[model samples]
Target: MLRLRRPNASLVLRALLVVVLAATSAAANEAEKAPPDLARGARLYSDNCGRCHNARGPAEYSDAHWPLIVTHMRVIAGLPGEQARTIEAFLRASNNPPPPPRRLGRLAAVVPAAGLSGSELIERYGCRGCHVIGDAGGSIGPSLRGLFERRQADWIRVQIQTPREHNAKTLMPLYGLSDAETSAILEALRAAR
Candidate 1:
């Protein structure tokens, strides 16, 4: 009688890893092939939409609302179907909300209350419509890429609290954020570096 040997655990694990890596690489290649051109979308938006009303940034609206708004705008503005779709893609990509913070469960007791990050606060307040944060945000306001390098914590806090105090002709509105919100945003900005 002939006996069969079991597969080695290490061999099985290596096979699985190879399969996973292959799948991941294939999916990444597919994605890269059809990547959306946000610059084209921005230009289209400026040329077409900016003709009438102020061209609102993508972050101004939620993902769900963008399709409807884009459809409406497409009809009103007489935009081509492909251009409309491209614009919609850009808006959806830009306004993509961050995932909700994970709950710590039992660890919550031991860990300090870590509030929302700077990016989160910025999104919550729709500041991306005016300011550029990283590669995703708009350019109506100043780019906050190196905000900490230019301004101090107190200055930032004061500017958020009272925009006019910092700049005489600032278009930024007073958000009237609470002290906790202010501190959380400030901490996030500091931690970003």
Candidate 2:
């Protein structure tokens, strides 16, 4: 027969309370710690997205409005799901309007030589860095504003095929282009005038 001295209810209660308090405090501390992947998230937003929209700034709309804007741009801009997400992250970081898609179209070849559009050539080799045409580009190279009027298609073709051969000191990089790309750029240049 066990004679239990009056239960030490106070001691048992105190021990339970200590355990509960310790667990709660630990959880709170963890919640207060820094968030993971903050730097990675920022880099991902910039490399794939900053060109099209501002990151982490004032947006014209509320958070609820962003999804609709993203949807429209993804389809119209031909962005893949991952790219769209990158753009979304950038826009969410700073509320900014997404850039519009560049306008491009193939020009009909008037002369016998087959070709790609001037716009296509520009986009393919990124010619905007060295040239400017009206409001379109920069000054890395000579302004080709009226290249069509100033140059012949055959001359342009030769230049595309081997720029250094024509001018050793030319700042233009040798694009190591195929005959087809040369023809296309020439055709587009001819059409530009």
Clashes of each: 0, 6
The candidate 2 region of ten consecutive residues with least summed lDDT is 103-112
Per-residue CA lDDT of candidate 1, range 85-126, in tens? 667766776564344335546544232366566557766665
Superposed Cα RMSD, model 2: 18.6
**lDDT, model 1, position 156:** 93
Cα-lDDT of candidate 1: 0.68
Q: Cα lDDT for residue 31, model 1? A: 54
| TM-score of model 1 vs. true structure | 0.44
Cα-based lDDT at residue 51, candidate 2: 52
Top lDDT hit: 1
Looking at model 2, residue 61 earns an lDDT score of 49
Model 1, position 138, has a per-residue lDDT of: 60
State residue 36's C-alpha deviation in candidate 2, in Å.
29
Q: Name every residue pair that clashes in candidate 2.
A: 56-93, 56-94, 57-94, 59-95, 116-184, 130-141
Runs off by more than 4 Å, candidate 1: 1-115
